[model samples]
Structure formats: structure tokens, C-alpha cells
Target: MADTEKTAIAAHLYVALRRVANRVIDIEWMAQNEEYARAIIKFAVEQGNEELARQALRYQALLDGEPAPREASARAEATPPSADTVKKRYIGTLR
Candidate 1:
């Protein structure tokens, strides 16, 4: 295959993988399996691929009733906070 064709094929595969990951996470959530849900997100994040991570995040948001994964208060608390997050919390407390 040509370089362009190969790139396109890879892009398509990434999208398909993201869709599958999202579905799996959703099913785990509906089953009330928080551990499995976290596992899915961890897998996606560890894959270091944007699409997979985004899909995992989307599923997390859906499970948490948030607009986005970053807005998931429970998930956010479990994960380590970033520098900016710490700053935000400190700033909020000062108000």
C-alpha cells in the first residue's frame, strides 16, 4: 500500500478501536463494576494513544453524569492531581 493509504487505514482502525473500547467501558459501568471501568480507562491511557484515551474519558464522563471525563469528581479524586489542579484548589479556597 502507498504511504497515504497506510496512514488512512491506521486512522480508520484507531477509530474502530476507540468505539469498541467505549462500548466495553459502558457495559462495565452498567454492570456496576467500577473496578472494570477504571481498568478500561487505565488501559486506554497507558496505550498512549489519543483516540483510545478520549474514548475512555468519554465513557467515564457518561458513567459520572458529567460533560467530560475531567469533570468527573469521583474519578478526579482518585487520580493524582496535576500542578494546575493543586493551584486551582488552593486558589478556590482563598475565595
Candidate 2:
């Protein structure tokens, strides 16, 4: 990858990892869409974006109760509020 593209990917992953670590920027969003993050990480890694992959790894470290670089700090309610907790349920008609 070119330097410019790598830089862009690095910055994007940095902010993403920072937000994931903080857990206050977008809790529901992240919790709901880790697939997107994983996809980006995979692409970045495939493209030889070490910095980007490092950023991705930092989030895993944070989840593992290990120290991770910080930037800011998901800093939600609704029974099964977010889709993440959604489960199949029967629906009843109301008058």
C-alpha cells in the first residue's frame, strides 16, 4: 500500500480502537457492529497495514482486561433494548 493510503487506514483504525477502548463514544454502535470493525481489520492486515492491525489488537487487549493505549473514554436501555440482545418472541395483537 502507498504511504498515503496506509496513513489514512492507520488514522481510521486508531480512532476506532480508541473509541472501542473508551467504550463511551458509541457503545451500542460498537457492540452492535463489530463485524464492520473486523472487516476493516482484516482488510487492513491483508493490505500490510501493521499500524491498523495494531489498533485492532489494542481493542482485544482492552476487552481482555489488559492495558491498551487511550485517547478519550461509550462514555443504553430499552427489555432487550439494543438489537444485540434481541431474541425471537411471540407477538400479540392489541385492541
Per-residue lDDT tens digits for candidate 1, residues 27-64, read: 42323565765665667667767666665666566546
Candidate 2 — worst ten consecutive residues by lDDT sum?
82-91
Q: What are the per-residue Cα lDDT tens digits for candidate 2 across 1-95?
A: 12323343345665654554432233334333556545555554554455556665655454444665543322334233443333223235333
Give candidate 1 regions above 4 Å deviation.
1-31, 68-95
lDDT of 2: 0.46
Model 2 collision count: 4
Candidate 2 Cα misplacement greater than 4 A, ranges: 1-31, 63-95
Most lDDT-accurate candidate? 1
lDDT values, one for every candidate: 0.52, 0.46
Root-mean-square deviation of each candidate, in angstroms?
A: 15.7, 13.7
